[model samples]
Target chain A: MACGRPKLRVGPSQREGGFTDSVPATVSRMENQSMRITALIVCLPLCAFGAATAQGLLLQRAGSQAENRPVIPKASKGDQCVADTEIMRKDHMSLLNHQRDETVIEGIRSEPYSLVSCVNCHAQTDTSGQAIRIDAEGQFCESCHSYAAVKIDCFTCHAAKPAAMEVIGNAEPHLMRDNPHTLVSYLLNKEANE
Target chain B: MSRVPVADNEKSLQARRRFLQGLGLAGMASMSYSLLEVKAKTPASSDKRWGLLIETEKCSSGCDACVRGCNEEHGIDDAGDDLTRAQWIRKIDLKDELTGNETSLPVMCQHCESAPCVDVCPTGASFKRADGVVLVNKHTCIGCRYCMMACPYKARSFIHETLTEQKPSAPRGKGTVESCTLCVHRIDEEQDRQPACAVKCTEEAHSAITFGDLNDPDSSISQKLNTLGGSQIRADLQLNTGVRYQGL
Candidate 1:
């Protein structure tokens, strides 16, 4: 009745008949049962050792491929970030959220935790010195975010590059419309169309 | 032309006269007289209500400089069809049916003190700032369009398509209702405060729009409003809109 099935108590003679093929027929029933228990104990460690070795090999392979990890770009502006690197890595979302509320809701724009500042410092440049967007493929934000499988929603509305970055052949004045957001792409497409 | 008759009552006139007299004394003393001296990097305070006064008589009907300036400023002209494109500011032509007189003015968000948009927003996205700038917090906005329905002036526009090349200062995207921010970014950033439309209007030589703190009696907008008189669109609603029109 233990486990919803009738637990029939097998006698030593019944066990002896059941184990006759596996255990030697001349061996005593007590000795046979003890040897079976010994075998079970020995198999457990062997299975665990095999699994441990497999895990160790995986760890070694991963460690050797360290260069495959996300490459964080150096900040172009300040010597250091507004916060420590480790702190920024962990708490940048909360910091940006706090600053967003202050700037957007309260109309306080001077704080250093702004997304614009992050782009100004972190955005990279191309061969001809045109600023590359931080969220573009293999770029600053994308490197880590794509590796971590985290989707960035900020650049959907916010510019991914600094506003002052110059795009080649754009004759427009450096006004708000000339910001390096879609304007660069828009002008480039227009140039292509022409 | 209809006049709003603001501060026209005997008691209000007496209070305004006393304020002007005090301002005159303060100005004569050369103490850099200002009700609220705004500093850099600070949140806008309730003490100063930012507003605009558009002289309709001066606003030229054919000119779309203000509209163009506003669109360029916010990066709203890049995409979307004419039917769905967001218009933060628009030039409206008004004609007096009986007298055959015509008036032209730029219309945008009125930034009402008791904003219907602020009232109807289910997610509290439409809110009035401390300085009385009604704004839509797109982060909280669910694109319900309830605020658009409630608004009397038809100020707000719903962004329909995915936007690109958004300005760093004005971050607009699809699935959120937006309106004229009254150039809140310029007011916050630049030392010389003027919305893009106002700046463009001035650049175009119309100089029809005047932006200043309505609470400051010494401010040009309030002073001009006090003397020349101004009227709000749909004044019967009593929203007490921050944007006013003169010679309407």
Candidate 2:
């Protein structure tokens, strides 16, 4: 209300110029304040943008933990995969899907991409020598599938381990052991007694 | 070596003709031997079509050796009721009304050339292998039971409950359709061994069921079919079933 100069009466700088000075000390102080306000207005958004960029980088680093990495099993026979590592990582599911159709519809059992062959090579065992099922944590198929958030329905109807080692201590060794036809001969012998 | 000099044109021409005749004879001998080898190896093809022949007259009414063998091979846990149980193979008792003639025989999947179950399957889970063995790929099965409805022999069964400790060769689980695979795992693994049912029946002295390659003219089933002539059940359907019955 007082011509926007309310601090004029209380200022020592006002005494230096008195009434003769056109540009008063109070006006200069006001200008300084306006400059500070303009600087603050310009710098605040830039500071926020910098902080946001730093936060995004931190999140990305946290997301790349070992739990999120693909769990590729160590090959028993050779160091290399059937396909290149990058190709297998990208297109394994599609390859398996195509192989399933070939095996089921066309009866082409000689393909190298069979799921049973995969299980034979990749299935691991615990310290106790018991087979780790496909759904178990840290297992080859489950670990990668869980990391990628994909549901696996293969173990529902297919064995997760090799045929020979699956029934190790069982009485019916012929069911899945090395000699697959032993059961037929056993049954034949049993029926001979009857 | 000593060489006798003769007339230039006549001797050289005679030598050339003998050399050509010798080459032709060698080629003919090799071709004839290769043809004989091919004929001899026809029975050993992996693509050979496998089938079963059942002699119904020789099958005993009460003996369940084949059924027991199949159940043991697959680890089929016995359910409380017949309707809920999983039966891969079963004994069927047939009677003719007019003649009052009765016979008992074991029955399972016929492995049709054009399977109705394969035709009606929504997921193409029911399929016939190149070797004429019909099988159900349970991974693609959605428990829709369409295959079960389309099967003429009621060979397929749906698992209503979860199963554990399954055989590695036969991984059965809940909510899928399964059926007789004709012991395909055994067939794939062993060259000389027959199916469990056939072996059991033969050892039990019934000798009613015979398993062999249908494509091989020298196979036992083919020779028997040639002499005794077999009949296919529901031949009117034109399924051309792999399993044939003698003395039906």
Candidate 3:
């Protein structure tokens, strides 16, 4: 009757009800109404799941390559403050250039676009028009990064300081690092000694 | 961890080639058909949609063709560089503290099936291309670098300042988080151009960069990964990245 005994909306008790003497009747009424509400909610999820499953199929077909892609969440605007670039030493560049033929891409956009992105925004122009890697502290990186919040250790291994105006030629040969060649090698070498 | 199996087809591929001395482009096309037919005849794995064959054993801590390949094929030309305006697919270098050894592992935007970057991009600039390469749309990018902070692989770039020569957003700009594109643009447009790193890499050294649709069982990336062992990086993140690391 009247659609499941009226809605049991929460509110301050009826000020005019003189209910000081009728508490038992009020409690019973509320319990009966609450049961109906409970029954209604239990079915919501089941219905939703059915609808979602059908929708998921269409979305999957529309976005065919959706399944195997990675799932990185969007960062809040606070991340806008994160530093956009990291400074690195010329030595690091030379060391990594095992192929030896240097200057393949001219700038960071060529081979290693990610690493080059550091240069793209961080490289500053002098009055003479020669673009130079800016001081990391005063860079656009430190700007919003200081504002957004969080710090990354990319600056530690990578040079946060300004690099030399000129790239020093590969004057010295590099020695090979002793890092693990594979995941197994890494695990075994790390656990073996311990 | 089991080792990922290798993609070995050189002998068969060579065997399928025919010597048509006077063949024209049409003949070459017919020959190519035979080459493809031979591969099609092979009993490929049935579970096609999500298999990758990464030979982690062969992955040289030294070579980074995968990282380099995506950059070149995408034509991301940000030459005058600044660290803050950085971008590219990164190759991870892990070091052994006691042994003083280092392992160079190529890594990039893993293109998670449920990507946080897409969820986090306030402007909806970060989106995946139809063919599987995940990318950030430069036009919609507001120069806000939130996507960079959200990316686990640190795969995004930003254009920082106003330059006399404002390069397009192919490589991302001065203030965006730039990572590997998986050469979606190249893969979509060019009928035959493969990813840059895979083509440039020397097979003998370490053929690390493997590109193909992992979901397509017959694809090179899928078949190799299926036969080999591959594990996603940072599995704890719950992001099913398109790219997988083998051997680990």
Tens digits of per-residue lDDT, candidate 1, A36-114, equal: 9999999999999999999999999999779679888787554656667776788688768766876776787765567
What is candidate 3's lDDT per residue for A118-154, written digit by digit as tens?
4333455557966433334445444444444446433
Residue-by-residue lDDT tens digits, candidate 2, B1-248: 01122122225434543553454346447433222222111111335888999999999788888898888678787655788678888899888999999999888999987778877777766766657788887777888999889888988888887776566667788998888888876676556668889888987898999999989999999999999999998998878889999988
Candidate 3 residue lDDT tens string, B1-248 = 11111011212212322221122234336432222222111111223222123455666776666655455445444466557544565556677799886656666667766667766677656654333345665535675778788788777666565332222223233444456665543343233445556665643456665766676766777767678757888988767777787766
DockQ scores of all models, one per candidate:
0.24, 0.10, 0.01
Please list the Cα RMSD from the true structure of every candidate, rounded to 1 decimal place: 12.4, 19.6, 25.8
i-RMSD per candidate, Å: 9.8, 13.0, 17.5
Model 1 root mean square deviation, Cα atoms: 12.4
Give lDDT per model, in order.
Answer: 0.78, 0.71, 0.47
The DockQ-derived docking category for candidate 1 is: acceptable
- In model 1, the Cα lDDT at residue A187 comes to 56
| Clash counts for all predictions | 1, 0, 74
lDDT: which is higher, 2 or 3?
2
Evaluated with DockQ, which candidate comes out highest?
Answer: 1
Residue-level lDDT of model 2, residues A1-194, one tens digit each, is 45775663667756687565765556667787999999999999999999999999988888877446776667433344556767677868865776565445444444455676677557776789766675678778887888889999778666666554323444344543343223343345446656
* Candidate 3 Cα errors over 4 Å, as ranges: A1-194, B1-54, B64-82, B97-102, B163-177, B202-205
Residue-level lDDT tens digits of model 1 in B146-225: 98998888888998888777777789988999999999987886555699899889989989999999999999998999
User: Model 1: runs farther than 4 Å from truth?
Assistant: A1-52, A165-194, B1-40, B78-80
